[model samples]
Target: MRPKLVLFGDSITEASFSDGGWGASLAHLFARKADVILRGYSGYNTRWAVKILDKAMAGIGGDAESPAAVTVFFGANDASLPDQRCGFQHVPLEEYRENLRSIHAYFKKKWPSAAVIFIAPPPIDEEARIKYPSGQAERTNEAAGKFAKACIAVAKELSTPVIDTWSKMQEIPNWRKSTLSDGLHFTTLGNKVLFYQVVNILIDLGLSEEKLPADLPYFYEVDPNDPSKTFG
Candidate 1:
């Protein structure tokens, strides 16, 4: 069986395979290499996500031939303020950290051979969120940083690689304008940024462009006369 790449998180991850989403970009990049699994919980925080982690990983069949890579990108909802608007999704800082650690432990036990990456929560544009038609002042840049740091700590503790999207996005000029859409969601450009960031991290971890070979034979390798001859 082919190896897998799992993306576990919330809305950002659920919509990742959508148009111009980071997950979609990876799908194209890893076309035949591995099956990209999206385990996105639209409005879940780590607390809720962990409850369903077992189900999400059930198909992985932890073993030597299990998933090749996994990215646990969460924290957006965890950083939500403990107010009516986002209280349901709010996971306290300490619990969030513990949740991450628990997730790492679960994966480590399940797929020990798989390389794991953690993605810190990205920043939120408070002003933009409030202006959003269906949004409230739930997430904030400050909380994002806090959770991002917490995520980084978990990665460091687990000896895994992490992508600090929160700080990285800020480095760019007019980042608010160019990096995010709808205050909480990513813009086209931001999606590209995430795709490349993930690519770079995978490469650094010894996963190359050709690491996951095309699932099917190259077009040229197929015989035009007897297409069946090309079936692997």
Candidate 2:
């Protein structure tokens, strides 16, 4: 069976299977080499995610091969202001850090061989958030940056790879429109940037499309004189 790459995160991850999304990009690139599994939960914070992790992991099959890599992408919601409308989703910065550590520990215990990657949340566009009020707590780039830093800190402590989308996106000019869609989510270009970031690290972890072997032989490998030679 092909090895798997699982995406574990929140709304950003949940929508990653949509057209021009990062998840879709990975799935397309790894077509026959590996299975890219999506386990995204919209409007979820680390607290809620930690609670459901075991149940989510159960679907991978206890006896089956462990995933080659897993990405923990959250923090966007956790960065919500405690006093804002979306305050209910807010998880304290310290708790967020601890939760990330716990998540990394759980994965390592279950599959030591798997590469665990953490993705810091992207920067928020305050003006956009105001224009398109989605009932989510009013978030600011500064607040999100804090959570992103905490995420990086946890990844460093755990000695794992991390993608700091929050910082990277801002490097681009006019990032508010170039990268973010609703001030919180990703635009197509944003997805491309994220996809490239993920693919680069995955390549480093030996999980790239070029590194993994395809499951079956090519059509050219089959011989007309003996079809069984290829089938068998």
Candidate 3:
């Protein structure tokens, strides 16, 4: 039987581009060998992801023998909005780490045999600041990076694998050029690049095969007519 892999995250993972988001692209890439499930929601944070998992498993009869792998990405929205209301804006770094730990623990207990890969949110381009005009986007980018590093530290404690998408994205020269026009999401090409990185990590960990296609295309240049061509 084919293995089951779930991609969970926010809008970026939800990628509503014409060609579908990175999760859908990943599903296509592994279509021949595995069953990929996209469970992303727009504007979802780690807190919401935890709740979603609870809802999925409530009353369902499943066990480790039929376990499903999960890839989780959050921290963007958590750091994006200010905390005057929930006071999460003032949430300490230690608390953030605790949140991650709780999330990992919850999934591990529920699906003991499943592989859980933590995915860090990608870096935000400077252009995104204009959309909010509150400078929260820049803060979100910084906080997301910190959150990624914190997740890495947590993974070491739990012995789980991480994709490190945040750092990989920083290495891309003029990454802003590859983003969607909105400057908050990735273009079709951006998602393709992300897929390549993710697949590589999965293969290195023996969770997936290394036999990926070589001629995968990405949107390198911005095309105003194509909605999929825009990425932040």
Candidate 4:
């Protein structure tokens, strides 16, 4: 049986397939090697996420060598300033730290030998993210960095891999305008960046052609007159 790859987090995760979608990129990369499962709960922070890990784990039962990877991406909402934009989801910094720790601990315990990777939330655009439609306002880059620090701490302690999206996005030119659609969500270009970043990581972690089953009969194996004859 093929192993599984799970993507877990909040809205960034829920919308992972939107536009060009990072999740879609992983799906194509894993192709026949694993099931890329999305377990994103829009607006959820690590506080809420820690509570839901068991439920998420229940959906996929895997031993050691299977389900090879799981990536945990979060923090945007938890870093929300208390006075601005959807404070309901904001978790205190200390709580956020512990929440992340709990999440990693649970994933490691539940899936004993599975490789767990963490993705720090990307920078937020305060200018474009003004409280719109209905909330207070703005998710600052400074705040997201703080949460990213917490995420990195968990990764270091557990020896898990982590992607510092918050910092990477900043390295790009005019990222606020080019990467995010609304200062919060990702644009298609941004998705490409994320796709490449994640796919490379998976590759480094052994998601190579050798590990995947042939997507289908290779073209060279095709019986032009009757390709079906070559299919299993």
**lDDT of candidate 3 over 1-232, digit per residue (tens):** 5667766677776663337567777677676666676666887766666667777545433673444577777766666545423234333567656777787887788777777888776766655554343434434567667777877787787888887777776676677667443555777666766788777777876766445332333445557687464553
How does each model score on lDDT?
A: 0.85, 0.92, 0.66, 0.81
Better of 3 and 4 by TM-score: 4
* Model 4 accuracy (lDDT, Cα): 0.81
Q: For each candidate in turn, give its C-alpha RMSD to the true structure in angstroms.
A: 2.7, 2.3, 10.6, 2.7
Candidate number of the best TM-score: 2
- Runs of candidate 1 exceeding 4 Å displacement: 131-136, 220-232
Q: Quote the positional error of residue 210 for candidate 2 in Å.
A: 0.9
TM-score of each: 0.90, 0.93, 0.76, 0.89
Count: clashes, candidate 3: 9
Candidate 1 global lDDT: 0.85
Sort every candidate by TM-score, greatest first: 2, 1, 4, 3
Stretches of candidate 2 off by over 4 Å are 131-137, 220-229
After superposition on all CA atoms, how large is the RMSD of candidate 4? 2.7
Measured with C-alpha atoms, the lDDT of residue 112 in candidate 1 is 85
Give the per-residue lDDT of model 1 (tens digit) for 87-148. 78899999999999988887888888888889999888888867355566778899989999
Error of 2 at 192 (Å): 0.8
Cand. 2 TM to true fold? 0.93
The clash count for each model shown is 1, 1, 9, 4
